[model samples]
Target: MPQSIHFISIGGSAMHNLALALHQQGYTVTGSDETIYEPSRTRLEKQNLLPAQTGWFPEKIHTGLDAVIAGMHARKDNPELIKALELGLPIYSYPEFIYQLSRQKQRVVIAGSHGKTTIVAMILHVLKHYNREFDFWVGDPIEEFDTTVRLSSTAPLIIIEGDEYASSPIDSRPKFLAFQPHIALISGIAWDHINLYPTWDEYVDQFESLAEAMPKAGILIFDESDDMLDVIGQKERDDITKIPYLAHPSEIVKGETFLITKQGKRVSTKLFGQHNMKNIAGAITVCDRIGITEDMFYEAIPTFTGVSKRLEKIAESTDRTVFRDFAHSPAKVEATTEAVKQQYPDKKLLAVVELQSIDNTNKSFLDKYKETTDAADQVAIFIHPGSADSGEQITTSDIQKAFQKPSLHVFTDSAALQNYLLQERDASHIFLFMSSETFGGLDLSNLAPKLI
Candidate 1:
């Protein structure tokens, strides 16, 4: 009989993907959640993995179950969690379970405050280019891969995009901590997850601990250009081989980005920007450790169009293009805005960002947004209070003062924001939609009414 695995709060992005992967692996998977969103819901329903109902059911947690995986969305006192505790089944956070699943395989964990998805996507693209067998879990959608997460018994390696956020409601440690990567890369270190890390030092300490936890003989890679990552890279770690990489040399010819090889050969790529160049370098470093040579990397990286929402081209024409990026943090926002502006120098760029996280909208972290969007000719900020239960309310004046951009626009209503974008759409303007959420339900992709 197939081993049974029950999931609590399986409707989550990662949770649902993990459940689907496990189900595909022939496990008897069952799950329950209070709510489930689109794509996840549709995918689950397609697999018959969705529970008969949305709410929790203690009866779902049975003694015959082989394991119970839970997401942070579920409280410790959840009925199913309490039932699982009563039954004494093997319960685990998805990250821990992933580590358990990959124990026999060499693990490559890509971690950072930003660039995690881009770096992972690059690595996956390169590996797949050479037909290397490996499993992976990444945040953003990749056109080459059917799902964001994959696992198989035959693969000898697994690469994961490791976020610094708490693993699960029951596990407060960062998700990357559980991977214990055989090879690890810290793309960059910037303050994030302020609610959990609270202070800059405390947040940095997590990456420090990640570097420290590497097993003797493990490989550590980092971006040398980032001051914080450079500091982390310099830490005394004689036990591991530490490699630092700078941005790969590149030039834009006819508005197309290309990677310059050591021999002065130009390797064309669909990706752009200095940050992506740095991300590509980090990915090459990792692939090198895994036995993929530089030549192999150059050939494969070009086909990697880009991640779904990271600088994704939602709409384009001869004169203008609209892009969407999952960039909400200060560093990401700055890097993304700069990349687009640099790519199309002559176009008028309108960069719009949405603040959906409670911590991100707080006054404590507000200063980070200062000048982050300066690269764009016009900047807009959207605040969706519905998403952030942040009882800490700030006015449009507070946002305007925080950004310090004289021409910056702020919107509290979704309709106003959509109308603003629609009105601003024109041939001379290049639109950049940046947010972690959907701009409180604004479909950036659907807005692609051919800005020609």
Candidate 2:
């Protein structure tokens, strides 16, 4: 008989992907979740893998199950979890199972507190351009890829967006720790997830531990431009190969960014920003390690549209443009704001950020966002007053005081914020909506047409 696997809280982004992967691998997969969201719900339904209903049933757990995979959303008190533990079935976190699957393959883990999704997307773009078959698991949906997760036994390469977040409820270690990578890239480090890591040094230590997890023959690729990474990369790891990459040589002309390659080929890209240029360089280094040459790297990169929500253009008019980004952290907010400003310096820039993610909503994390919005011609910071979870709360005054920028505006009500934005936005201003979560139920897409 084929192996049987069950997933707890399988409706999550990564959990659903893992369930699909296991099913594709010929396992008799079953899963349960308390709630199901779109995209995951639709994708899983298409695969005939959606649960019969929303909630979990303890009866679904049986002794015949070969293994169980638990998601972070699943609590220890979950009936299915209790059943699985009672039966003594082998259980794995999503990352743990991925590590097991890619153990023999050349695993390239793209890790950092920021830019992980973009860096992973960049590497995948180049590999896909060359038509080289490889399995990958990224966070966001890519335009060229069918799904965010791909797994195959025959594929020789696997690239994963190595997140520093917890793997599962039972696992306190960061998810990246599960993948003992043959090659790894640390883009940059910044304090995030205050609820988890608690301190700046504790967060920094995760990357250091990730570097130490690499095999002796493995190569460590990191960003030399980041001062913290530069220091961490130089830490005495004599057995592994340390390859540090700086930002790719580039210049902005007429508000357009072009990359100058070592071979003198000037490659212009639709993607903008110094941070993106740095991401491209990091991707190039990883691609080189996987046998792709510099010429091919430059040739393939021009076709990259970047991952969805990483500065995704929602609508465009003769006089204005609207962009939506998944930038929620301090560094990401700064980088994305600066990118938009630099891209359209002649146009007035209006940036609106939602404090929905854990890092963005935290009081301690707010200080790091001090001057991130300084470049914006006008800025609005919106936080849903009743949206605080896990006892984390931030008032409008707290946010205003934290940023200390004269142009900053704070709003607790999403509707009021939307109204304010509609009034403030004009034909000459570029509107950028940034958040890792939904805008407190505001439909920005519907609002975009009215703005245009």
Candidate 3:
């Protein structure tokens, strides 16, 4: 364990959690972020870990620090980063430091464009169920755990949610590349991060690179359903153990989802969706290899409602339910929308979305979402056309033409969309808000009550 560490941008969700985890492990943890937000600010303050002041102070980066963990939000030329570089201090990007900590442990890295968080969360949920000792790093908050990152000396394994996004400002490599795992699971690969991985082939090449990074004897578990993953799984690799899994056979009866195991055992769960079933299969395979039994996996999974924002239920009435999900990417959007509609075939489905990232709004990426909206009965897209916005040129006609949904509603202002939805609340329906961004800055949690 690192005795003393300084975080360049601690206010970030994962970064703050890692800092808190290290602090709990008896390490000296200090962090600096120009601006800190709600949960991060409050959590850090609770632990007395909040910095005396905000912003970078090069003087704070001294020789006594054991190392520096840089967050993605931090710049290449941050004053503290510059000072750390000047002092010849060992600087590790967020992912790099996580890798360093778990190098000796059996590293299980779940990597893909989508479903990574769910798969990782499922694995962790099961591991904890049977009292199996392990540390984990997941991207989103889970109800099973207080923090997203955990480190313990007694744990013999570590599970990581491997993201393909760039590690940090100075580190150009993808974050997942840092975690050379003993067990690697690629849930599914879809072309994403158009701004960074400009071409379809280039986007896929990142997954191939991840496969190449694994040790010869390492076990690679992948989604056989994915064409790209199928190709990767079939490619010659005599030394590595390759395992392929598809969606667990299941049936949805009366709004309930049940997973049918290989032995024909029906496992009931609160989770819904074919994609979630596939995520379960991927997680089950990973856990099975790590010595968890089919029964144990089944027993633990039903307890996991879901990770935060992945098809999470925010508010509900007798007939209407409102859900908010972190699904900005095309694949995620299609799966989440389809899942909700599948679960409630009799109910009216309204899928609201906000394309937050620049990559999500790119014209080249528009084709990816062509058929995604077709799953919903109605589609409402909210894009704030302002100074920092992407897809400013995109119009309702373009979206209508692309999605083939002539009734698609496009709103540049959140207020108008809110008003429209509030007015339309007389109908009992399942309102699904799907976005990596908040619905044009509308407080959906607060609004959900009124809609109900």
How far off is model 2, as Cα RMSD?
Answer: 1.8
What would the TM-scores of all predictions be? 0.96, 0.96, 0.96
For candidate 2, the 10 contiguous residues with the lowest summed lDDT are 384-393
Tens-digit per-residue lDDT, 302-414, candidate 1: 78898888888877777778888888988889999999989989889998898878667877788888999898998889997543435656778778988989879999888
Q: Write one digit per residue (lDDT tens) for candidate 2, span 1-452.
A: 23798999989988998888878889898999999998889989988999999898989999889889999999989899889999988888989988888877989999987888988888888887778999999987778887789988889999999889888888878889898889999999977677788888899989989988888898999999899889989787869899999988887898778999776768988789888988888988998999999888888888888878988989888888899999888888899999999889899999999887676677767778899988898889888776554685678778888887888888877898889888986633799999987778889879988777
**In model 1, what lDDT does residue 179 have?**
92
Off by over 4 Å in 3: 387-392
lDDT of 3 by residue, 187-291 (tens): 888887877888988889888988888897989999999998899876877588999998989998888899887789888988899899899999889989999
What's model 3's lDDT at 289? 91
Give the C-alpha lDDT of model 2: 0.87
- Relative to the true structure, candidate 1 reaches a TM of 0.96
RMSD of each: 1.8, 1.8, 1.7
- What's model 1's lDDT at 326? 89
